[model samples]
Target chain A: MSDSSSSFISNQVSDISPVQSSTTQSQRRGSSADQDDVILSIRSLCKSYFDAEILQDINLEINSGDFLVLVGPSGCGKSTLLSCIGGLTDVTSGEIFCRGKNITQLDPAKRDIAMVFQSYALFPNMTVAQNIGFGLEVRKVPAAERKQKIQQVAEILHLQPLLDRTPAQLSGGQRQRVAMGRALVRDPTLFLFDEPLSNLDAKLRLSMRTEIKHLHQRLGGTMVYVTHDQVEAMTLASKIMVLNQGRIQQFGSPEEVYKRPANTFVAEFMGSPAMNLIRAKVIVEAGAVKIQIHREDRAPLVFIEQAATDALRAFNNQSVIIGLRPESISDVAARDPQRSHSAECRIEYIEGIGSDVYATLKLGGSDVISRLHGDSNVSAGDRQQLHFDLSNISYFDPSSQLRI
Target chain B: MHSTIKRPRHLSCLLYASLTLLAFFVLAPVLWLLLMSLSSPTDLTKVPLQWIPSQWDFSRYALLLDWQNGSGKRFLAAMLNSLIIATSASFIALVAGVLAAYAFSRRNASMLLMFAFLATIMMPPITYILPLYSAFSELGILNTKVSLIICYSAMLIPFAIWLMKTNIDVLPEEIEHAAMIEGAGTIYTLRKVVLPIILPAIGATAMLSFLTAWDEFFYALIFSSDLSAKTIPVAIADFSAGRVTDFGVIASVGVLASVPPVLIALFFQRFIVSGLVGGSVKG
Candidate 1:
């Protein structure tokens, strides 16, 4: 299972188009010669309380100026993993190297890591300026310099008017900005955020997310952020690592994780309106492979794979799970003209979430959902023709659940 | 509509009556004490409690405050001793108990130690007095304010720690973690961040400890004999124990003894209500 999925992962990484692949290559070449580009490295990190393991042997490397997002469901240890990297949670047996210095045994303060917590964790007793400058004050920075730096950070976060207001007096977004200001004032080696935007309303979350991304771009600081929101992972991450049950399911660029997931878990977990897993039987017709999806009625729908990989060929006539995302079946998806197949099915219901219409239908003996255009005037019981993008489809072994 | 309009008014009338009854039940003794202190000797001894005094004699209070008088010096010294013991005991208990509570809350220190501290207070005061009396005598600190301070501190530390611990537990650990990650040390974090956030709890604990030490009688009765360390409560007991007891003087002393606590309670009621009592309701 590991062998096949690792091969799939490498294939996806190398499968980027000419321009992206070249720039990726050039970036690697430029960074390979100097170890300074490595901002944080974890070797065999594991965390457990008593006999209950929270994080397994985790190994990762973060480059300087990288926005790495750790995303997973609740209790997947993403925040614990971030805390380990920041020296808040001690590892069972591992070494954490921050900026090439071993910081596993170091104190959290000496590790020089700045973190913005989920609750904002702003000191309730202090004003905004006092809260932002606390780290400076604790470190015995001169009062004049601390004031200047706090003012500078306040200017950056546009918190000039709120400097004298306590956290209880500030709005949620303002408190969030103050938290960011606190982190920014320290100039720590790495920035950590544990679901820092989860507390805000949807609109504020979006604006804060955009502001954080812009701040990262402007400062070019290395950040390791933890969130259970996959959209945040997809939008903010240069490298997104999906975790489950204290293990990394997949770590790759957002496009790679979404387009070509390493395993069925990654395939299902990395997208909104998660990827659909359909039980299908593979058949060889004249030495070419086709998957017959068992529909509820009428007849079985068969889709052909013209460019089947060698890994897929190994499971020629066996039952496999066909991982199909909703967009792959939407009518608005670009047709490949040759490889994209179309099937007509009856819609069960339609849910319009303002931006897109999600139509639920029965296909391959499962309730499959499709992302349709918002203005599409289709209701329940209407027949609709959906297209399948073979290029976007993922094949998983039924028992092992690994991508082939 | 007519019933709804009239019901609240009738209900409020009943409610106010119940409230008045409860308030008088709690305050009737203090009010009677004030009347006894203000009445002349003949008025206090008269039958049917002399619901109204013939003359408002202020002579008992005058005698109590007269430093040149015989019992006046003892009363003033005992009052000073009570002040010294209660304030010092409260201050010491707060300092030590707050630190321990922080450990119990943030450091995940042994619950066994906390339970042991509580077990000391759980024991009856009579049980501690014997051993503590011997201990103080052997240590040559008998009849001194220091011995009483120690005893009161022992009695109050657990209460302080328990109150402080509960209040500290409600504060988010992430706040402290965030401060530590930003280079604040443990003591610094406690003094700056934790102390300020839990100030209400500290206020409540200090107020309760002072009140307890101020009213403590058994330890002061057994431990101190004279002007050196006898507190107000023990002195009041001595006044009542005399064969020819002056009810007016005793009432006046009782009234004077309660003044400090009443003033402190009024000053710190907001903290007490918002801190520990509020936590109990929330929990």
Candidate 2:
């Protein structure tokens, strides 16, 4: 059943134009060199609980050896999408392809996938070794191989010394490792992790995140991890799928998603302290395109960026949201005036974060934050000249929220 | 500070005096029964109200044990019958109740089935006595151990399920899901994951079931007409009502009947308290 659907998608891939085909081929090669071949393809997935839609049409493809992350806000459907792939949840309408076959209707066990839950659901009655061997035992793997494999997995997870200990005897982090080892020994086609480190302390979470990345690289197994933590998504995923309100906001390589967000939501959702969004209106005057930003209690200003102007030619007089990362804005007082784009604003609050300073400035009828070096002279309630890099600004249509 | 603390101490003495008087009012009848069991048979109805036995005779205990002289039944045999009935009934009830509790805990079973079972506990046990008695008699099990076990198990399952269901609900569903993802089926997860966490509640339920079986007197008296099925409680009651009541033997049997439950509590006191508290406090 899955074979037919996979063949159908492959057939679809074969019918594209040469330009698209080559681009896709290059893209595939880029991922294939790192990850295994394609193992799971989620197409047009939609789910609604009762009548409230929790996931919209989600389209994602998981290759054989890739660390894919589904990340978003609490109710953005990232966990729902991950659960759908693992068959822990049912999709309202979609097809899930596993190993070149359709497995949307298959039970979780039959899907041949291993998942580590966020809670690290170790069977409290079983020892660490027993928990690790449970999956293999269920599949009727011979007892000897199961034992040997469990031992090997325990060693890999550094749980060999604790093999005789039940989950009740272990700490939270130890139990988490046992949960991972349980999935690890399965050696299945895919691994699903649902915020596995969320229950750990900050130090352990960082270490575990590094370990997961290393393990993925070493095994080169196909993995789909779900987390709301952006740092984990950035560090662990080769491809990140950003979701918002049951819809995919953006799906691309981590760098691509970070550098070229598809919309304001993706841009703001990905960065720490978030990207500052300013409301502005595009205007055309004397055959020149510019933006007029009006801030209450401040003088109005006109700004022009050639790229933004050209891209928004037909969007004159339309309100647009401007996206700027904190680091892209700096204090004009310290930075070379000739090397920076300048804007005038009142300083609202200044926060120092070790190596840099973040000053929240009122500008363009909204608040924009600037990241300055450690010696920045800006202080709270002080009028300041802030410089925003024109080349790094992202413009989004106010209504559609699509990037221009 | 000492003087301030003494004010509550004085108040407590007054409260203690009143509560002690109330306790004596409630316990006076029990004290009278104890005195009656120790006094001579003629002294039982004496108008002088003899609180102490003058002869200090132990012949009643000997006669009650012989049954040939007391109630035409053996105390040892009745004691054995009670043990078998209570243990078997509680054990069977636990098995059935755990299975049904697990089913109700995980799935959304019909309200009608749950309520129908619960309704049995709400009605007095005598409400079903005639039908149950006729069925047992027709099946030749009216005075058998099997009849008591089946009846006790049926009577206790509703309350057990209700108690266990509450404990099971507080457990995170994720634990079961994780077990399932790890390849455990429903039964394996229940036995390995769910059971251990709720062990306290299971123990508490067993204790409650055993107590219910031990304290039951109506069914034992109505159904058993011979030594083979008569339990300790029935035998004790019968001996006390005879033409010559043996007070010492009744007290000894009463002490014996109380031993098992007291031992069970002593051995599992921690589990019983923890389980009951865990269920109530959700900690």
Candidate 3:
């Protein structure tokens, strides 16, 4: 058991060596050269209302053309953070630098940031063309120039046909497009969106999301998008910052955050159906580690020679949380022989959603769902052997709630 | 389909019946006033009430319009005074009230301050008449159009603020935030966005303020000694006070005085309905 675990660790170390060296080399160069590309930098940002803190110690650096999304549950301060960046809300304490200048005390108008609100905020009294060109008008741009710019933005947003219509006359999606046109016409240093797609129906929301992503690609401007929808963050962001309870849970590329969440909150928050958390005890036996998961009315399943034994050494005989996404577990027939860890459990229920099936099973006295491709042959009350992919499993310290 | 059509016919009959009833009750007074304005002096003094005058005499209207007759001169001066007072007072109140309401709607101003402004509206104007008269006299502006304008504006400003504030509150704050982000200052946002959206409500409020100022008799009666500053309401009241009261002339003055308000209301009827309902619903 010890030999197999050690071999796996050595293989992972070898695999990461080249990538690690390149990353460190880039880090050395990034310190100075990257500073110029940092379009926005927030340092020690804290905001409070009365005695209650709303945001704390928020430090972030957004680079040029980076679409950074602040995502969390309701009341998690994602919108507040976006507001601080846009200079709409004054920070309680902290400095925000935009284009290498501190804009902490600046007015929203002076900040050179455009924002698209959830309500679209298109002036109801103004025509689509007027709404799109309003910022230019405010800047005192000449009428011809403003018209040309509005034309350009309207063309890009496919709003040419609706130019003369007021916001009330346009459909919800059209209104959102006009809002995008308004923001785009400014060509500001940064763009802030506060749950801009929340008001649209699901179908429109999906299309609008794609449209925004395409716009981001075409414009390549720095934008900070705030949303409670993790799917939006996953799809739209170049870097996703997961916030929970006014603090950052994780900030990383989508793959890094999804595959390796920093903590339990992120693990639960980032994925649909969420990561399945199971309480298990670690046991050290003869220089190897085994996980003991106890089940009610059944024999305990002891997983031997887990690959994470070295990291689990200190946690021997102590409770640790095992996080596995639904896709990680599958029926025995569908499991890859070389990559899966098999376990026996009784199927509790089955939920079929079109192309896939989800089997609910009792494992270690907890309900664990296994996602299977096509129809799952397993039925309720059937004792089934489920295979869990070992490589994507996350281990967390129960006390600290941090990933091990 | 047949049942649906039949039901609508029945419902529409009931609707039309109620609407006719409402129209009669509403227009009866105006119709009666019109009849009186056109009645001969002898016809007005008859013991039996005449819904339709046997002889229609428009001489009273002609007398009210002409500046030659003493009563005509007094009526014209009072009408002019009412016009000036209503227009100026309503304008002043609207301008100050819109600015105050915008400020009150913002987060910086405490709710207590809003309530304080609203508290002024809760007090009846009659309660402040004596103090206002003393202040006006002390300022040496009594019996002047400016004094009446000031008094009317002061009386109506609180109401304007309350109505405008509710209407402004219903506007999306995000629109203001969007404007601010677009390099627009507070004043610019108000001018370009806020004002246009709330224009209908402002029109409604202005009409209301103008009518209130135009109809106010208590303050005008106490402050003005003659036709120089007295409004239509006071002038119409004065018509009944002589040894032999001319009911036809008095009714003529009342009808003339009502024309401005009635015309303004008719012209802005659409705005009035929307403005009144605007506060309770989002745009």
For this target, which candidate reaches the highest DockQ against the unseen true structure? 3
Ranking by TM-score: 1, 3, 2
Give lDDT per model, in order. 0.85, 0.78, 0.84
Give candidates' CA RMSD values in order: 3.6, 5.7, 5.5
DockQ of 2: 0.32
Off by over 4 Å in 1: A1-36, A332-335, A353-355, A375-377, B1-7, B270-283
lDDT of 3 at B226: 88
Kindly report the docking quality category of candidate 1.
Answer: acceptable
Scored against the true structure, residue A400 in model 1 reaches a CA lDDT of 74
Across residues A1-404, which tens digit of lDDT does each residue of candidate 3 receive?
Answer: 32343343335334543553344335334333343387899987999999988997777776777788999999999999999988888999999999989999999999999999988888877899999999999989999999999999988989989999888778888988998999999899899999999999999999999999988877777899999999999999877888877777777667667887777888899888888888999999887688888888588877764576567788989999988899988874434456467877787898888678888877666898888776667678888777878678888888767777
Complex DockQ per candidate: 0.45, 0.32, 0.50
Question: Which of the CAPRI classes, incorrect, acceptable, medium or high, describes model 3?
Answer: medium
For candidate 2, the lDDT comes to 0.78
How close to the true structure is residue A208 of candidate 2, measured as C-alpha lDDT?
Answer: 92
> Which residue pairs show collisions in model 2?
A2-A101, A2-A102, A3-A101, A36-A65, A37-A64
Where does the lowest 10-residue lDDT sum fall in candidate 1 chain B?
A: B274-283
Q: Locate the minimum summed-lDDT window of 10 residues in model 2 chain A.
A: A8-17
- lDDT per residue for candidate 1 within B1-283, as digits (tens), equals 2554555778889999999999999999988999989988888888777967899989888888888997788788889999999999999999999999989988889999999999988788898878888888899999999999999998899999999999888888888899999998899999888888788778888889999999998999999999999999998988889888889999999998888899999988976666543332110
